[model samples]
Target: MEPRDTATRYDQIARWWQSQHQNSSYGIAQLKRAIQFTAQRYLALDVGCGSSGRFINVLLQHGFEAEGLDISREMIQLAKEQHPGTTFYTEDICCWIPPKSYSLISAWDSTFHLPLNQQEPVTKKLCNALEPGGVLIFTCGGGSINGEISGSFQGQDFDYSTLGVDAFLQILTEQHCTCRHLEYDQYPENHVYIIAQKCDRSTSTTPN
Candidate 1:
């Protein structure tokens, strides 16, 4: 699907997104791990942040300055209501420019919305927005490219055309980001969790 079309589709489902994952234990665990792994009191940005502000709240609770951005205005509004003190903007992840480098960038379950062709550029932009030692934590839908899978949520059929773990790792490596940690085991129903650190440009030959 086109990027705008994907944004519209998500906007239409924003109200129901939180409810769909209200009882997800795995989701909870993933968020907790992301927050714990951040381990920085510096500012953080949550890209493609949906309606649920659980991760944002966790960051704030741990004394990190947190903000979020999403393509869906409806999701942004819901996030604003849940986190009035924090900032939330309606912005496309592909082209959004953050005002300052963040200590951490979190993209939980949201990167799956990007078409495979757009992932590399977006990942590169995200790397540019990270501070010297910043970390990027994200999850991608897990499946072989040729696999067929479908699920229903909010009266719409959700399909998976995911990149295999190896292919996904190649994208990161090509972007000049090293994968410090990765886990993708629960196949057919799994998502890849990745933690990549931004290498210091001054100390290294490349700009991360």
Candidate 2:
């Protein structure tokens, strides 16, 4: 499901995704955990924020000023409409440069969509984008190796890839983040999530 037109595919479903999100609690639950783990309620970034602005809203409610980025222009448009005063970017996370360091960064269900090859590097960039003691929370398609999986959503094909559990932990550790929580609690579905905290540079370990 590595469609040549990823952005367009999501654009086609932007409204549908937004409408359906109202009844979903998945994002909210993850955000609650992210907030609990975050040391500061300063600035937060929601990578791959879809039209719903669910994560962004949660950040705001908990005292963080939030901004978002999504690969789909239509999704960004819808998010802007839903959250008039918030900033939302339409750029692929794999190539985008984070504008500022954040105390909280939540990729949630988004980063798994990046190709397997981009996982480590992009993740490292994300870790570097965090301020000391900042928290990073994201989900991955649980597995032991690198690979891709395809699925159809609302009749459109989409792809998900991962660098596996071990690789993910290694990358985070190399970026000087401590793995605080890694849960496959949503087992049987290949869904795994992790909450990691950036260590203060003074006490950080240099990756060999």
Candidate 3:
């Protein structure tokens, strides 16, 4: 399915999403781990950021000027209302150009919804959008081979795709970013998260 179709699907359940996750602690620890790798907290972007504003709140609390983007208009509307002072973009990730580089970009449970072929290019795009010392934190279905699967959330069906672990590592290397951490956080479910940092030539190549 196209990204806009996913947006439409999410639009149909925006409030249900917020109501379910508004007070949840779901990605907090992982997000904070990614935050520590960023050398500068100047700017952060939450991609595929839904209506809950959970990640946005974390970014702001960590002292970054945060922005959020989602393809769903309803999701962006609620996010804008909840985070009135922050910038929100309602656009497709594949078609939208980042206006500026970010120090920390969190895709969280997003990105995997892209059509299979768009996976590598979008990962490259996000890697390119990072500053020299920036960090990218994102989630993907884990395995050694590329694949796509269907899943349901809040009664709405959705698709997820991944380029697999090796491809992701190769892409990060090709983009000049180093994979700082990769974990199958939900062991049996294949839910994996990765933290990668853009190499900083002026400093040591490892996260402090």
Candidate 4:
């Protein structure tokens, strides 16, 4: 099935997703890494934010004024109710353009669901959306090369795809982002995450 199809499926299960993820720790590691790498907390964007405001809440705790974007209208609606003060948009990250740059961006386990063909372009766009010295945290399949796969979520099948490490590095490099950290967050699982920072004109690399 096409990756875009997940939007409809997610819309149908928005509440179920919110219930499951409300108290989850699956993305805590990535969020912590982002918080560490982000020096400024002016603004943050959460892509594919699902129906839970958990990450948005964390960003607020870190002093960031946060916003979110998701493809599912149902998900956005649920998130808006949970986070009335935080802005949330219903748009596909594959084609959505940021109105302004962000100090920090988190895709968590979201971007991997984009079509394989759209992965690289979207990655590059997201990297470009970063303000100078901005931090971007995202996840991808921990495979050695570019590929796609199918997975079942709550009995419904969905597609997951990635441009892999090589393409990711290339996009980061082209966008002048320093790869700060990368790891298979769930070691036994294929869940890989990365923390990268857009280079400030004065600094060639992120601080160690």
List candidate 3 segments past 4 Å from native. Answer: 204-208
* Residue lDDT tens for model 1, 52-148: 7877876677678999998888888887887898988788887777788888888887777676667667777887787876788887766555243
TM-score top scorer: 3
Alpha carbon lDDT of each predicted model: 0.73, 0.87, 0.93, 0.88
Compute the lDDT of residue 28 as modeled in candidate 2.
82
Show how many residue pairs clash in every candidate, following the order shown: 0, 0, 0, 0
- lDDT (10s digit) by residue, model 4, range 82-115: 9998888889887798898999999988899988
- Per-candidate TM-scores read 0.81, 0.93, 0.96, 0.95
Predicted candidate 2 versus true structure: per-residue lDDT over 68-131, tens digit per residue: 9999998999999878999788888888988899999999888888877788888999999999
lDDT at 30, model 2: 72
RMSD of each: 3.7, 2.6, 2.5, 2.5
Candidate 4 vs. true structure, TM-score: 0.95
